[model samples]
Target chain A: MKKLVQDDIRTGVFICDCGSNIAGYLEMKELVEFAKTLPNVVFVQENLYTCSEGGINEIKLAIPRENLNRVVVASCTPRTHEPLFMSACEEGGLNPYLFEMANIRDQCSWVHMREREAGTQRAKVQIAMAVAKAAKLRELNRIQLSLSHRALVIGGGVAGMSAALALANMGYEVDLVEKRDRLGGILNELNMILPSNEPPDKLVNNLAARLHDNPKVTIHTGAVVTKTEGYVGNYVATIRQNENENKIKCGAVIVAIGAQPLKPEGLYNYDGKKVITHIELESKLKQGDVQAKNISIIQCVGSRSKERTYCSRICCMTAVKNAILFKEASPDTKITIFYRDMQMYGVENEQLFRKSKRLGVRYVTYDPDRPPRFDGESVSVHHLRMGRDIIVPTDLLVLSTPLVAQDDASEISTMLKVPINENGFFLEGHVKLKPLDFATDGVYLCGNARFPSTIREAISQGLGVASRAAGVLSKEALFTSGIVADINPETCCGCLGCVAVCPYGAINFIENRGICQVNKVLCKGCGGCAATCPSGSARLDGFSNQQIYAQIEQAMAV
Target chain B: MSDSQFEPKIVGFLCNWCAYAGADLAGVSRLQYPPNMRTIRTLCSATVGPHQILKAFQKGADGVFVGG
Candidate 1:
């Protein structure tokens, strides 16, 4: 690893035209001239497209040619293009973290298109700030930690089973833990799945049998993850089962604990007898026990309201499937489904809705403001199209409620140091970029634990999370960011502020020395502790206060 | 406020996770704001100390905004 000597810093600044997206609004030549005047900037180049092949080649060749150790690219947003420029810098024999980016196109010219003079001036200032920060930038090596080659799957439902199987099949040992004594989870209670109308038992049986037969997979029923320690690539988990605690070591974890059905206790006069939730109805339907001649299903029971803002995503399809099932059981049994909007997303769900209609199931669209009133044996709904109140006599009323996060989700989230969303589901790292991963590196999320999902979607996410977890387990070692927090013992006052403010628990107080120490392997490079340290003893490796002050001084310089 | 020639040299400390992303979003959406501000990116808002803000003002910055 090459260490960066700040005093002898050689910085290169690459300004991009972005194909006139930036040049159209500002004078490119003036910005280049301004960049060269900045301190420590030895090389300056302007490209038509810095992200293009030719532009990248120019950067790759310039590092050795100019002896540039720190590179700054004044291009587009780093969110989309930072990785590209960082890799290009790495190819040029510079550390990937030794590069910085300034958004000249998006944050400047594009936004202030009409103000050419002001935008150009602002661009110059932005470039100056990048160069200023670049001069103080340090080369950092990635922190690599060995993997255990074993995975912990935290549920035995459809999602958990699928993830376990995916990992085990890929030659990695798996530990599948279920809270319930059975491995099927909620699937065991479900009657039949949509589209195919296949028995849920068959799916569960196949998954359970395969999991039981796999030598690489270990099944622990009625087990709960009691405690978790360590960081990514090295996790120690304590599983409690049958009054005994067993410790397991694994590289990554897949959280697929799933969700529970919301019980609409008061609203719609639900007694769990006459007006029962869909879960109860599904069980009865599965056992061939439903004897009602006239059945009514209401959608958005506890969801799509002021309290619960999000659509459950799967309940509308579930209601459609259940309605169709009733119509199939006995042709004389009339089934009516009242919903605000039919959320049959994919082709299969749409087909299920169409088939339900074909099977003579009545579909009614109702206004949310004027919800149907249940009176034990009957429901009175204001017909939107008909503009009249119609009373339908029903023997059983099924409330199609959304799935809510488990009560212990917060407890588990605390144990793992992961976050849950406002809706209480596990928050992914990024909605699109990292759908299967948590912000924490080692932990992954799938199935209804992230959001309400169908069995098929859950299984798909299970496989997706399995692949992500396997990527870490299969690697010889996992490398983390090197720009982490560092404590200077010389300037130390052991206040323990950094220890408290650190979200990753990377800081620890050295009791004997009366100083603070940073666990580099656990530090996420977030720099929370650095800013909170009263003595200014803790500072991030690359983003030290000196570097930031330099950038600030240059940025505000007239 | 009415002086056209008085272009305020403002310094902004933006966090990499949120504020920087928000700024990028504004640019991607073509939302325009004042061009007087110069931004320095930090790993987190917590990383920006009081002295950094003081340094900006001491260096003749008219205004300073610390965004996470």
Candidate 2:
């Protein structure tokens, strides 16, 4: 830990009116006036659009004149504007990371419109907390790590195979691991690709063959990673391949654990014979018209939470494709899609939606609360629009359920030290920016494992992860925010509180000394340790409590 | 000013699902948000990431809302 420096640290607190977006209900002038009274706040200002270049320039100008070493902005969600304010602070000659953003917009104002006084009171508390959190902020340097240039891809499905091939073509060593005895996972279950009607098996095999032929690629069939440990660039993961257990060291791990179809138990008493899935329906479609005149497809049967919450992203398209098939074979047979919403998003999909309508394929929207019921032979659905329940007699009822994440996601997350979202899918670093990256470095999630994706999206995510991993592999020295967890041996109580909160397993207490030490490669520096610390010992590199608290005190002092 | 008028300022906490991307499409297609609606991207409708929704409310936005 760096010694606490008392440099007469001056801070500038900018309370933005946001043009009454903040000032309308709550008094922004009061807030700005309140900010000026805070400790170390050498400068306090208000702006209509603090995000504007002029407002940023105000901060920039204040730094040189007042010698401000810290900054705080009371504004909208930090996720949207924290970076902007940080850049402004950096332009003002302050360390970017040293700036703390207190989110007043989303947290207080929008949700508490009913009670203005209470909302502003809460906003004040939150701003105070943020100031408290930011006062301890410190300057951070990027932590550098030496990474091995190799990629470990799980699941030898089309996604994994595609990723392996892509990485290998880029001259990277590929370790392709599959749990099934064969390479294809669900690709084996498919007959052909959509629209193009090309055999998916052939495409999967072509890639698998190339993977087999390449010396840079190592194919492990009937394998699963039993234990995964480490951070980005250097991860020691053990896999049980073909009854043989071996640990492989790699720079990156790509989780392409493709989804499994949700088969509802007891619904229609689906014996796989009488009530089958869409896959079985496909086989029946290829065999020509059935003797039965009616067939109904149920959408969102076990999907969207509790029953299963998630759009199953591809189910609508899949249903549309299946509906189109039914209309083509038997014109007399009625194929109705009992759906909540036909999520036919794109232009091509809209065309498909229109085409299905023209083909006499019925797409019905059912209220989610009062879902469609199956009577073994006929399904009953209540139409909210028509205000009546209609029954459709069917020979075959195909439930177009979603592709759910693998059952082993929690186990895998624990091994990798990554978090699974509430829906039990892997969470990415940022939804928009780092779509493929996990909060933990080196580990990347793609395919249906991240979310229920179509074969196309799965392949795209797989290839994307491959390219991202390749970027890290190409770097001679990998660098990360030195803002990782660090231990103070002097204040070490020997208790392992930091170890539990560490999502990356970066914190550990060494033997004999009974003091915690951070694995620099794994620590993400989220300050989760500081939050859990009892003795105030655990600290992150740059965002230390002392630095943040000092900044807050300094801001308030102004 | 009409800007200060009681136009319902919609704050959308869109999941990256049909909601957030839909908003993006609304933007790319130049679908106006009454010029009052603002958005914050979430990993999904499930986890809103940090305390962003609260921050939105604190900023005195008329009403904070989410869509997925």
Best by lDDT: 1
- Per-residue lDDT, model 2, residue A508, is 77
Which residue window of length 10 is worst by lDDT in model 1 chain A? Answer: A1-10
lDDT (C-alpha) at residue A207 in model 1 = 94
TM-score of predicted chain B versus true chain B for each candidate:
0.91, 0.65
Residue A163 lDDT in model 1?
Answer: 98
- Name the runs in model 1 displaced over 4 angstroms: A1-9, A267-269, A374-376, A532-535, B1-4
lDDT at A312, model 1? 89
Clashing pairs in 1: none
TM-score of each model, paired residue for residue: 0.92, 0.65
lDDT of 1 by residue, B11-61 (tens): 888888899889888888889897888878777888887888888889889
Q: Per-residue CA lDDT of candidate 2, range A187-279, in tens?
A: 777654666556676777887788889999998888899986666778777989767899888989988887788877776667776577887
lDDT of 1 by residue, A270-333 (tens): 8877788899998887778888888999999989999999998999988988888778777888
The whole-model C-alpha lDDT of candidate 1 against the native structure comes to 0.88
Considering summed lDDT, which 10 consecutive residues are worst modelled in model 2 chain A? A549-558
Question: Which CAPRI level is candidate 1?
Answer: medium
